[model samples]
Target chain A: MSRIKACFSVLKESHKKALIPFITAGDPAPDLTVDLMHELVAAGADIIELGVPFSDPMADGPVIQRASERALAQGTNTDDVFNIVEEFRTKNDSTPVILMGYLNPIEVMGYQHFAEKAVKAGVDGLIIVDLPPEEADELTAVIKPLDLDHIFLISPTTHGVRLDKISEVASGFLYYVSLKGVTGSNQLDIGAVSEKLAEIRSKADLPVGVGFGIRDAQTAEAVGRVSDAVVVGSALVERIAEHAGNNEKMKKEISSFIGSLRTALDSI
Target chain B: MPEVMKNTNIDSLKSMPDKRGHFGNYGGRFVSETLMGPLEELEQAYKKYINDPDFIAEYEHDLKHFVGRPSPLYHAKRWSEELGGAQVYLKREDLNHTGAHKVNNTVGQALLAKRMGKRRVIAETGAGQHGVASATVAARYGMECVVYMGAEDIKRQAINVYRMKLLGATVVSVEAGSKTLKDALNEAMRDWVTNVDDTFYIIGTVAGPHPYPAMVRDFNAVVGREARQQCQEQAGRLPDLLVACVGGGSNAIGLFHPFLDDKDVALYGVEAAGDGIETGRHAAPLNAGKPGVLHGNRTYLMEDKYGQIIETHSISAGLDYPGVGPEHSWLKDVGRANYVSVTDVEALKAFHDLTRIEGIIPALESSHALAYTAKLAPEMDKDAIIITNLSGRGDKDIHTVAALEGITV
Candidate 1:
């Protein structure tokens, strides 16, 4: 099962929301991803969203974009992403893995093949940034039998009708894009977020996980108070960038940042 | 008046975008997986070497002594009389070495590229200005330079193509996409992807993933920093407003940075209105764009529902692009700056006005700033100062303008 679903189990028993730390799969260096994944989990990542590097990631911010540049620079593709996941499975079998990426590579790989490979490689969920909730029927049909959860995004711009569709379709959780703009923009209206959260909760049965712009413990706590989880990618990516070229420094820093974030989420 | 906006933490690490760029929604690392690692390395390298006294001192010395920065803040006495209203000041960025504001960033980025010990550099250009600047720096540093330009831009900007060749730069003509700036950028990125092991990609503006927007803005901020102090020393106060044309927004952003903290100073970025704003053929991203992703980062982009960029048109080849920097978006929302648009007709008229009155021909890109002044001057007081960035000299546009007028320059 997906670590995301397991997080809810931990949440139900501990009365604390989960902390999902996002990291681009190949950053600082491509060879470092699998090791970094283990470090993130040990550092308090209840769930790990491993981003597959794509040529274009429309939903990402600059930090993530830079990560993509590093991975793309090194020529890390979907096949490489699967290999990384397969390797991670050898060391960590209990943690659920989510392949968070755009749809181009999956489309290129063919849905039937991708679903099978992703499951065999130990991935439990998929979050294609560009796949709107309505258009996911084709992929869902292919993956439903495999029992892999399909995650859907719920933006502040998402209407009630769309929220209802996403809720029915999403099995893992609802990704709440905290703002209307793309990831890494500079402003957020708390009032707008609250209103959108109310809309999702009113219709969606799945846990609403808020992301985009949750960069610090203070901000993560603020978001954790409002939802079942707080997804922080840029913050973790920033730590990776902070210790570029030094594997030990990168891992240590990432763990420290995640530890702080875990404490913040649990406080809520 | 500046006291209200003065941030005392100007010299603190507290100003950084928290590794993730959470400037209260105005910034973050909205990039893809491939670039994240290298970007982090870049950030770390910048942190280690960028603030070194020697690195900063070398950069500053080159700016003042080599590039001849503190470029003149000239009083456009003649143009002011032509407008018959407000006093006008011209921030003469065109007087800088290499004949444009682009060299400022090129010099900074090139220096950083050298510090990283990268042996080769690649860049993208639209009007060839950035290509020429990059080529110049690569030659100075004895580095191999590859510049990508649209097949169309290579044709229109032949002189710059020749200059790059003379500088021993390989100019790659990109024909993919619309065969324009966007396509050229895509091609350049492809090169970076293939060669990131040994090559450094020098982006030309205040856009792209994190650190880049801030980094480019700092390099170009020399324009605003000098102009601000000069405007104060000479004019005895800050200008009532500041205006510049936007094209990848390097020149405008450079000129706008220092003034960002100046609350009373009204900043304006005039985008190319082209045929007209409503005609669906302009580059006025701030006026018409929705917040969609483009070119690896999220900013105001001219795109369709499917995220394919719509074709853009402008009198200036450089301004014929579909996005604005993220900083401009932040500024637009906070009301620190107002973005406006000017059509080809107004820009042409301003071009004519500057040529006839001041004997200075400006590039179509700079003409957008002139157009803003034409309208804004008539509305302000005679004593009120309005400084405009004459981003580049217009000699290269002589062929273009001559064709338009049915006369040879």
Candidate 2:
């Protein structure tokens, strides 16, 4: 079984929800990413979603957009991200690392080559934000053979027919965007998200990770009660952006924030 | 190359987008899942209204009265004589109500929005021509309008910003990456995804997701249709060459779409080479960039090796974009149209020359096409007819031109 499937199976047996913390690789500094990944794992993160900084992250709001800008300014490429994952893999192997970003960089690298490189680099899954299931066939063909989980996003607007189509091709977990807005935008209604999650669970048998506007521990805990996994991105990245000038403080702050959310999810 | 020739059939060229919006491996709905429903709905609406006679009649009536369609194909006699080669004709789209060809697409989209019972319309603009055009249509139809423009563009094209506001549009200044057209497009897409129910996104250019490229092209194809017929009647046959400047390739595609089947009529799309393509500061994506997905479609984009879209430069704010329309990419690949670049200095010279020779102050965007014509016209025979779409008037660019001359104007 793949690392993601194994991780979920372990969590399911323990009757524990998964905590997935996302950070843009090379944000603040490239050398610090591996250490941060390890920190996230230490803070009870079951899965790590490492963002590959794209120049135009349209789906992201101001917070994650700033994270991408910082990462790009530091010259973080796909290879650098792979290296970060490889470095993290040296210390940790149990936690699944999902590389999340837009699709253009992978397109430039060629689907087959990227999937091969990603597998070699110890990437367990991919969450290409812009690439829906409709456009995933070419990449899916290559990655599926390599045992790399192809995670797809299901937004609030995704209806019954599209949900069936997405669930058919998606492996690993399905990321359900809790709100109708971009990542980091406010106004996530827990009731609405719960309702949507119930509908999504009925359609797809995969573990559903809820994200996009889970800002604090309470929100994460609230989402965790209903979701198989709680994914926090812009909130953690915002903390990193706040302490960018001081790497030690940024690392400590990020760890503590994730630790709080992990504690909250465990309590739930 | 030989195989490409054998496949260049008129029917195949016209029957593009093939239901799934693939334009020969270019153009697809690469948007987020949230937008899929809206885009599918839009595709159906476009298919419905685009064929419905009542919708067609409404669009045509607006084109005639509001947009001032059948914009004259004026013979640039003095400019042609000065070039001393080809007889040049200008399809005067600059004479449209909003001072550019952008209004043609906006009018069509606004009408579509009304037909679909949409209350609000949102658009992204770079040079603000499309913003002004969208605002004009929104005002005409009494619909709420919002335009997203790059902060850099909002500063450069303040007059157009004021014009949009005057037309009752709330212009949102985007300060994202590059602070330009691509960023504005990103914001617009985000907005559309957020408000997918009641809002309609009127994409300015012949780019974006599926139906947008095809729909926008169909709306703007009136430029080509009129130019083709006028050229035939005025010159007794189709012109040997057609030229237009490409930003998101709306105007160029507008003029070239109707003429794509005419094997004898060559097409040229002039991209803005800000300093030079070699200097790496231009917006000539087709000439110097690689294939990548951005905004909503896969096309030629000016990107770094890591696939990060690089900042593009052009004296014309409209053309300063990292990507071109997908159809242009397809046309370039299929050997149907030739893409070239004109430097800022060359476009400035063309702007001046056209003003002096023809008493026409063409937009810097249009001046790129005129600049290429100045080079190509002198090489062709005097009897050779060349038709160029003068995409816009230069009034909005006077400030930029004056700034180049060290004047504040």
Candidate 3:
């Protein structure tokens, strides 16, 4: 079984919701990323979504965009991201690490080459934000034989035949963007999200992870009630932005924040 | 019926960007899932109305009365003589209402926004020509208009920014990622995704996901159609060579699409070589770029080996984008069009040369094509006809040109 599948299955057996904490790779500092990944796992994160920085992250809000800029300013690239994941794997091989970003960097790397490098680097899944399933056949074909999980996002706007299409191809989990806006947008209606989650669950058999607009432990707990996993990105990234230069303080704060989310998810 | 065309057969040139919007391996709906629904809806609307006689009539009616279409194909007799080779003609898109060829697409898209029952329209612009055009149409039609422009562009093109404001558009200054056209486009995409329900994104150029490249091209294709008819009527034959500046490639695609099936007419797309191609500071993606995806389509992008887009420079703000439309990439790959580059210095020279020789102040973007024409016209046979797309007027760029000469005015 894939690491992601096993991770979810174990969580399912324990009647616990998975906690996914996302941070841009090489953000704050490149040297601090692998340590942060280990810190996340130690803080009770079920899975880690490490962002691969791109110059233009259209789907992201200002917070994550700043993270990407910081990472890029540090000279981080696809190789650096893969190296971060590989380093994380050396210490802890059990926790699934999903690399999330736009598709161009991987495109430059070439699909087959990217898939091979990703699998070898111990990356468990992918969440290419801009790559819808329609344009994904080539990449999916390259990654199918490997153990990597090709995840797809289901937005509030996604429905009917489109929902079926995405669900059919998506593996591991379906990330449901809870709000219509980009990450870090303030408005998130729990009622709307739960309703959308119910509709998504009806179509896809895999676990549904709720992201976008998820900020605090309370909202994470609220999302945890209806989702298989709760993804917290901008809130953690915002914290990282605050303590960016002070790596020890940044890691400590991030650890406690993920701990709160984990505690909130465990209560559910 | 193949979803992706590998080879550009002459017969298939006009029917390109197959059903899934692939111009060979270029141009696909590569946006996030949230945008897929909106893009599909747009494609369906585009398909339905583009063929409708009512939509065509309405679009034409507006073009004739509002935008002053069939802009003259003027013979630049004095400049042609100065070049001393080919007889040069200027497809005077610079004379269009709103002072550029951008209005051609904006007028059509604004009409579509009306028909689709969208109450608001949004646009992204670089040099602000498209923004002014979009704002003009939105005002004429009584729709709420919002334009995303880079903060840097707003400073450079202050007149057009004021023009957009005068037309009642809320100008949003985008301050991210190089602070130029691409960043404005990114912000516009985010805005569209957030407000897709009530808003229509009037993509200024022939780029973006799907239906846009094809649809925008069709809207602006009137340029080629008229230029073809005009050249045949005035010059007594089709021009031997067609040249146009390509930035996101709308005007060039507009002129080239209709001439794609005309085997006798050679086409040239002039990209902005800011300093020079070798300097790594230019915006000539087709001339010196590799294929990558950004802002929703696969195209030739000025990106590093790591796939991060590099900031492009051009004397013309409109030409300062890292990528070209995907169709241009396909055309370049299949050898349907010749993609060339001219430096900012050359374009500035053309701007001055045209003003002196023809009493025409061409936009810096169009000056690229005009400069290339000066180079190519001198080399061609005396009887050979070269028609260059004068894409816009240079009034918007007077400040930049004046600053270069150390003159305040």
Candidate 4:
């Protein structure tokens, strides 16, 4: 079975929404990245999404942008991201890691090579924010050979036509953006989002991961009531960016944050 | 080159680069995979249009009638002796609408956008010259226009930002990293990703993925074509030297395009050395940068050890850049064109001298080119003619100059 399938099997058996926490690889400093990855997984993250910093990430609002800037300022690149993953895998290997970011770095690294590298680094999936289904085919063609899940994004603006298009290729989960705006925007429309989740479920068999505007415990639990995975990115990125230089403090804050998210999801 | 087009002014005998993109070693497309299809499509379209009898007529017709082409090749009578160089003549591209040579390319690309049935136009502007030019044509063509500007640029060039809005263009002040031209480019790329189906990205300079550098160069080459023909007709011989400022190097390439085949004419590219190149405070990418993939193409870039782009500084907002067009790389390697730079102090001196002597105020961007002429002209013979492109008039730069000099206008 694919790692995402195996991961979902755990979620199904436990009857708990997956607590998906994200942190930019090499934020604050490159050396501290691998340690932080271990703390989050141990703290109750069912899955981890590693952000590869691009010079411009439009889908991200201010918090994540600052996180990425810190990571980039510490001189992070594709090599650094993969190395961080490899280090995380040295001690703990079961937690599925999803490589996430824009497409430029992947394009620069070449699609086939990036796929092989990600698989080698023990990556389970990808969540490129910019790659639409039409463009996802570019990476999917290369990644599918490695049995990697190609997660896709469906937003509130995504209509009947685009949802159908996304359903055809979405694997592991469909990332339902709760808001139309960028990550860390104002508020999530619970009614509209659940309707979007229902709309996606009608056409596809994949589990839905709701993100973008999910911040606190209440918000996470509220979204987890409807979606299979509550993917919290900006808030976690904000936490990392805030405590970048202080590693122990950063790990404590991150683990506590993810633990609360996991509790909220379990309660839901 | 035949100069008539059945009431069309079609230049029938023109040439294109070979598959590897070599235009006599002065122009060629050296790029990566990100821009292959777009560049190929652009090359095919540009080749077809430049040779097409109808395209020539319409393009040249607009250049003459609409844009008021063959702009004055003025003899700088007072400035000539003041610089103590061979008498200098400036091909006044600043007289073109939108106040720079940029509109020449915008008009061409906008025409192509119209032909492609695209309704929305998106562009990235560094100093807002190209943004204003793009907005101007978008207004004329009745297309929905959106301009992306770095937040820093929007603050500095507020006048041009307002001009774009006045022309009914939506000005998006991008607040990404550095908030400069490169950031604006990143924002425009994001916008393109979102709306690529209906939008045409009007790149400001002869740089970007691939087709953009070549396409922008071809369109703006009107400056060189006009200057060369007019210089020969007026002086009865070609200039000893031709000069223009280099940012993404479009103006330099445009002015050098027609003169490259002229073996007698020496081409000079002038870059802005903001403080001094030695101080590591300069925008002279050709002189101080290394080759790298930046701004979607392979070219000379100002990057640090880990490939992070360094901030470039120059008094001239337009010429303040950390990279140059790739064709400039081919030119520098071939020894076809020589590039040099002038410090901000020298450019400002040239700026004041030109305003005082010739009653001509040049944009600080163009003053870098004039700085080269001011240095070289005095060393040449009286009969040795040096022609430099006065790329834009200096009205936009006057406040900047007054602020620096603490002089009341």
Candidate 5:
């Protein structure tokens, strides 16, 4: 089984919801990323979504966009992201690490080469924010055979044939964008999110992970009650931004935040 | 290389950007899943109304009365003589209402917005021509208008910014990467995704995901159709060459689409070579960059080896984008349309020469095409005809010109 599948199965068996924390891979500094990944695992994160910095992050709101800018300023690229994941795999190989970003960098690297390099570097899954399933076939064909879980995002806007289309090719988990807007914009209503989650579950067999407004332990707990996983991005990235240029402080902040969410999910 | 549409098969050549929006391997709906529903909705609306006679009549009626369509194909006799070779003709898009050919597409999209029952319209602009045009149409239609412009562009095109404001658009200054066209596009897409329910995104050019490229091209294709008819009526034959400047390539594609099957007429797309392509500071993606995805479509983009889009420079703010429309990429690959570059220096010279010789102040974007025409015209036979699209007027660029001359307006 893929690492992501294995990780989710383990969580399912334990009747526990997965806690996924996201951070830009090379944010603050490239050298700190591997350490940060290890720190995320230590803080009880079941899965880590590492952002691959792109110059234009259209889907992201201000917080994550700032993280991308900081990462890019540090000269981070796809190779650096892979290196970070490879280094993170040294001490811990069990926790699934999903690389998330836009599709251009991988396009420049070519689909086959990217999938091979990702697998070689111990990356478990991918979440290209801009690549919808209609345009995903070529990449999915190469990556899925290599046991790379090609995860997809399910938005509040997605329904009917479009929902079916995305569900058909998706693996690992379906990330449910909890709001209608870009990441880090607007407060998400739990009622609306759970309503959508129920709809998403009707079509896809994969676990549904809710994201895009879960900021605190309370919010994570609320989301956890209805989702197989809870994803917190902007809140963690905002914290990273607050502690940027101070690596130790940033790690501590991230660890504490993830630990709180982990505690909340466990309680749920 | 990807078995693009060969120059042969002119009949089917007009049906490009196939059903799934793949123009060869270039254009596709590469956007977030949140946007997929909206884009599919847009695609359906476009398909339904494009063939409907009611939509066609309404669009044409607005074009004739509001935008002043069939802008004259004027013979630049003095400039042609000064160039000393080809008899040059200008497809006078600069004379259109709102001072540019951009209004042609905006008017169509505004109409589409009305048909879809959208209460608000949004757009992204570079030189601010498209912004002003969108604002103008939105005001005419009584829809709420929001224009996303780069902070840098707002400074350069202050007059046009004021014009957009005067037309009642709320201009949002984007202070993001590069602070230019690409950044504004990113902001606009985000805005649309956020407010997909009540908003219609009027993409200024033939770029972006899927239906947008094809839809914008269709609306602006009137340029080629009119130019073709005008050239034959005035010059007594079809022009030997069709030339237009390319940024996101709406105007160029507009002029080139109708002429695609005209085997006798060659098409030239002039890209902005900022300092020069050799200096690696230019926005001439088809000339210097490689294929990559940006702003929802696969196209030739000015990106570093790592696939991060690099900043592009051009004196013409409209031309300072890293990527071209995907159809242009396909055309370049298939050897159908010729893509070339013009430096800022050359474009400035053309701007001055046209203003002096023809009493026509061409937009800096259009000046790039005129710059190439200045070179190519000198080499062609005097009897040869060249119809170049004056995409916009230079009134908005007067400040940039005066600053270059060290004279404060």
Candidate 6:
């Protein structure tokens, strides 16, 4: 079994929900990313999502957009991100790392080249936000044999036949965008998310990880009950943005925040 | 069927997209899953209405009455003589309602929105020509309209912003990445994803996901259709060459699509080379950039080695974008059309020459095409006829030109 599947199976056996902490690679500083990934794992993150920053991240809210801008300013590239993952793998191999971002960088690298590099770098999964299942054939064909899970997102608007199509192709876990708006938007109705999660569970057998607009321990705990995994991005990145000048404080703050989310999910 | 015959063999050109909207590895529906349903619905609706006689009739009728169709194909006699070469003709898209060729696609999208029972329409703009066009059609059809424009563009093209507001559009200034057309496009896509139920997105360019590039091209094909007939009657045969400026490539593709099969007519697409292509500050994707996916389709983009989009610079706000349309990418790959770049100074000179020689103040965006024509015209014999798409009027660009000349106005 793949690292992601094994990780999920272990969580399922423990009857515990997964906590995924997302951070942009090369944000604040390029050299600090591998450290942050290790930090996230130490803080009890079940899965680590490393964002490959792009010039334009349309689906992201302001916080993540700033994260990307910072990462890009630091002159981070696809190889740098892969190197970060590779560095993390040198220290910790069990923790599954998912590379999340837009599709252009991977396209430039060529699908086969990206998949080969990603597998070698120990990337467990990919969450290309802009590439839907309908258009994922080229990348999917390349990544499928390499044991990299092609993770897909299901939004509030996805329903019926479209939902089935997305669910069919999705592997590892299906990311459920908790709200209709982009990340960092304030309005997330937990009841609506719960309802959607229920519907999604009925259709797809894969574990569902909920994200977008998820902030604070209480909300994470509430969301943890409804889904198999709670994916937290903007809230953690906002802390990094806040303490960006001081690397030590940023690391501590992110660790403490993810620790709180881990604690909250464990309590539930 | 006869329409297909006037060009080259229809079978080769018409069989494109192949149901999945792929224009030979360029165009595809590469959007988020939330948008899949809406895009699929849009595709279905487009497929149905594009063939419906009643729908086509209504579209044609509106083109004739509202947009003032068959916009004149004027022979630029004095300009041709001055250039001392090819006899040049201008497809006068500048005379369209709302002062640019943008209205052609906007009107088509608005009518489709009405038919789909959408109560509101949203659009993104850089120079605000498209915003004004979208706003005009929204008001005409009595639907709510919102336009997203770059905050920087809002300041530069304040007159067009006022015009959009006057036409009943809520102009939302985007302060995102680069603060320009590409940023406005991102914001518009966000809005459409958020409000998929009641809103219709009217993409101004032939870029975006799947159906948009093809649909916009089809709507604006009137430019080519009329020009083809006019060339036969007025010039006694089809022109030897066709030239147009390409930003997201709506206007260029509009004129180039019908002529794709025409073997005799060579096509040239001019891109904005801000200072020059060598300066690394231009929007000439085909000339200086590589293929990368952005804003829903695979196309040539101004990106760095890391795949981050490079900031594009151009004197014409409309052409100041990082990517071109997917079809243009395919055309470039297949050698169906040639892509070139013109610096701001060259385009500005063309802007002045056309005004003085032809008594027509062309938009700076359109002036890029004129600049290339000026270069190509001098090389060809006087009997050679070249048709250039005069995409817009220069009225909205007066302030920009004035600022360039160190004038307060």
* Residue clash pairs of candidate 4: B5-B8, B5-B9, B85-B377, B85-B378
In model 2, state the lDDT of residue A134: 83
Deviation from native of the Cα of residue A196 in model 3, angstroms: 2.1
Ordered from best to worst DockQ, the candidate numbers read: 5, 3, 2, 6, 4, 1
**Regions more than 4 Å wrong, model 2:** B1-10
Model 6: per-residue Cα lDDT over A34-151, one tens digit each: 9888888999999999999998998888899999989988988899999999989999989999999999998888899989999999999999999998888878888999989999
Winner of 3 and 6 under TM-score: 3
| DockQ of candidate 4 relative to the true structure | 0.11
Residues B191-223 of candidate 4: C-alpha lDDT, one tens digit per residue: 664455567889888876556777888898989
A156-220 in candidate 2: lDDT tens per residue?
A: 88898889999999999999998887888788899999999999999989999999889989999
Greater-DockQ candidate between 2 and 3: 3
Pick the winner on lDDT between candidates 3 and 4.
Answer: 3
lDDT of 6 by residue, B194-258 (tens): 88889999999999998999999999999999999999999789899999999999999999888
Q: Which TM-score values does chain B get in all models?
A: 0.94, 0.98, 0.98, 0.92, 0.98, 0.97
Off by over 4 Å in 1: A1-268, B1-18, B22-27
Q: What is the DockQ of each candidate?
A: 0.03, 0.80, 0.85, 0.11, 0.89, 0.73
The C-alpha RMSD in Å for every predicted model, in order, reads: 16.7, 1.6, 2.0, 7.5, 1.7, 2.6
Q: For candidate 3, what is the DockQ-based docking class?
A: high
- The DockQ score of candidate 1 comes to 0.03
Question: Higher-lDDT candidate among 1 and 2?
Answer: 2
Candidate 3 on B1-409: residue-level lDDT in tens?
2122245443567888888999989999999888998899899998999999999999999999998988999999999999999999999999999999999999999999999999999999999999999999999999999999999999999999999999999999999888899999999998998899999999999999998999999999999999999998987899999999999999999999888877778899999999999999899989999999998999999999999999999999999999999999998888778999999999999999999989999999999999999999999999999989999999988889999999998
Give the chain A TM-score for each candidate.
0.95, 0.98, 0.99, 0.97, 0.98, 0.98
Candidate 6 regions off by >4 Å?
B1-10
In candidate 1, how many Å is residue A108 off? Answer: 22
